[model samples]
Target: MTLDDALAALKSHVEEGRAEGMAAYHKQTREVLGIPNPALNDLTKSWRQTLTVEERVALADQLWQSDIFEARIAAAKLLTQARLRPDAAAWALIQSWVPDFDSWAIADHVCMAGQKRLVADPSRVDAVEGWTQSDHMWTRRAALVVTLPWTKQNNPKSDDLAIRDRVLGWAASYVEDHEWFIQKAVAWWLRDLSKHDPDRTRAFLDAHGEKMKAFARKEAGKHLT
Candidate 1:
């Protein structure tokens, strides 16, 4: 099917799932977060069945331009399945969605899967690193999460200290962020990294203990003795 067809199908699927009065909740979330866009928390429970890589890419392109949050989310879901595809165009489409990310759901949905594609193709790491420093909190969260697979794969080693340091630095900068999502992301990265090297995490925490926010410290405590 063509991109238009895929988008149309996705939009219909999303509209069917839209909840009454959800607009109020979306507005409240935006107001509380100081974000400018309308958001929808509801999402499809499943992806479109077995979409071709090209079809998925087309859907992603269309969804990227959509004003509706669910449309964009649907696109992200489709892209996750296509993450293993070797299409450069598909990767570009995936990368383009980073700046548009506005919520943890979007960041986690895309990054957890797209990260494998990125690590396999190292060129994508630069973009992730750049996002880690972005002013946008979601982008930074995406950067940290995109490395999750790598950390899980290699665990912590002296050789990977630089990577660990970078992740910790990102967490440190955002540890005290008032935004709950940002604080949670900081906690998550610390917790995930701690799984690799609990000792190093303890050292890092102790060294920067005074600097860590209570929430981060609490989360890190899961693995750090």
Candidate 2:
């Protein structure tokens, strides 16, 4: 389908008055199509089933360039699959969107899609590591957000454990960044990691909790004990 057709399909699902409320909630200045997430989820699922990877990537790029909030969300959902062979294009496109991230809502959705690609190719973390040093807080935050899958492995092997530790090193470096969102991302990674590796979580807290914002420190320790 063409971009016009996809935009038409998305516009068809907009809810009356929800757009205004969503815009305010997300602090979004762009066009906010008041489509609920379930609708976008269903829409992208069908699109994924029908569209080839190249088609979906092209469409996702169009939707993202539209700068319409829900369309961006749909773009992210369109590529959120766990397995997409030769996903280099999708991964690269997602990377291209990083510098454009200005809000948590869209960034989180795209980062979820990114988690799939990163897990599909863990070596990509090398590129993601550079994001940790970016001046853009959201981009730096995306580094933690996308790497979150490493936190959930119940019985991690040597390499998975190595990745998990590597991401922790990133989190540790973030402790000095006092931005609320950055601290939250660090806490989020640790909180999730705590479920699967409490000892590591506690160790992180013991070593760096003294420097963390109280809320983040509490959040990182929430699952422990």
Candidate 3:
């Protein structure tokens, strides 16, 4: 119920020897709890069921401020549900975390939670567009990662199609960035889009792939055939 109580619950799951390996893997300098994802998943699932929306928000904020790896992951999982009606607070809190992202593991988990909010209200993409212009790479990358749902629609309606293209425009803007993560995010969006919309994927590669890093270009075209 309290932040200390939630953190104590997280600490109870820490594995003794795994902390160093997790820190090395994520290249994160923060305190790593070494709690495996399955355990964190199970824990946060129970927390989500047991806690009210405001309680979850407060807990997630505290967990994130702890700067402990697994605690941050737990914070994200707490708000990852798709049907949190009137989720303005959850969505706002998730947005607040974007600029603080320093690792892919944390950013990806937060983005997963973000995808649910975006799906609940597509207009949120307008706010996400600002992330594309952000000076932070992780914030920029979050834009693509969170909008991934747009890639999976095999029979999207006109509005969904528009949203998909809007995200593609963001990807295109990122092509010249040359950062490994940015290129990867661009390729990830394109590669996933290739699965359901090969034409758009190919078109993206044809236009911007030439400007992307060679590895990213290859990845963007991986499923194009």
Candidate 4:
């Protein structure tokens, strides 16, 4: 089926329950100084069961052309789940859209799933590095979180170390960043990495103790101690 057909099929499934849930979440978010974009959440919950990878990509391109941020986020979600597809285009879209990722939810959705698609490729490291230095806080957080699944799978040591170092370096640089989501992701990355190599994490934290934030140190130490 065509991308338009797939999108229309998916859009028809946007239930009241999903919309209500999204609206409620948006309300809670607004109360906490967060951006309350509901379209992504609503679209995510309405994913189609039969959409093909190419159709999703086409939909993403269409949504991006239309400047529909929520629809693009939904399309990203769909592409991420189409496991065997080449993700170069999706990565390019995310890179171009990184500066626009003002919310932690959308950034996390893109990174967590989009990063999964990049694990086997060496070229993705450079993209992660560039994201680590991005001015956007969520992009920096995405750079760190994208490595989480790799660390957990205990992939080849070479790949693991490259991603590990980038995550730690990003966390170190943002240790004192006041952004709650970035700070929390820093702690979460440390906590996840600590499970893979407690001794190494302890050593790194010890060496960087003075520079590490309290929350991050606490998270890293949860299992190490």
Report the Cα lDDT for candidate 3: 0.93
lDDT (10s digit) by residue, model 4, range 183-210 = 7787787777778777657767777756
Q: What is the C-alpha local distance difference test score of each model?
A: 0.62, 0.95, 0.93, 0.63
Output the TM-score of candidate 3. Answer: 0.98
Give the count of colliding residue pairs in each prediction: 0, 0, 0, 0
TM-score of each: 0.74, 0.99, 0.98, 0.75
Ranking by TM-score: 2, 3, 4, 1
Candidate 3 Cα outliers beyond 4 Å, as residue runs: none
Best by lDDT: 2
Report per-prediction Cα RMSD to one decimal. 5.5, 0.7, 0.7, 4.9
Return whichever of 1 and 4 wins on TM-score.
4
List the candidate 2 regions with Cα displacement exceeding 4 Å.
none
* Candidate 4 lDDT trough over 10 residues, lowest sum: 27-36
The positional error of residue 72 in candidate 3, measured at the CA in angstroms, is: 0.8
Clashing pairs in 4: none
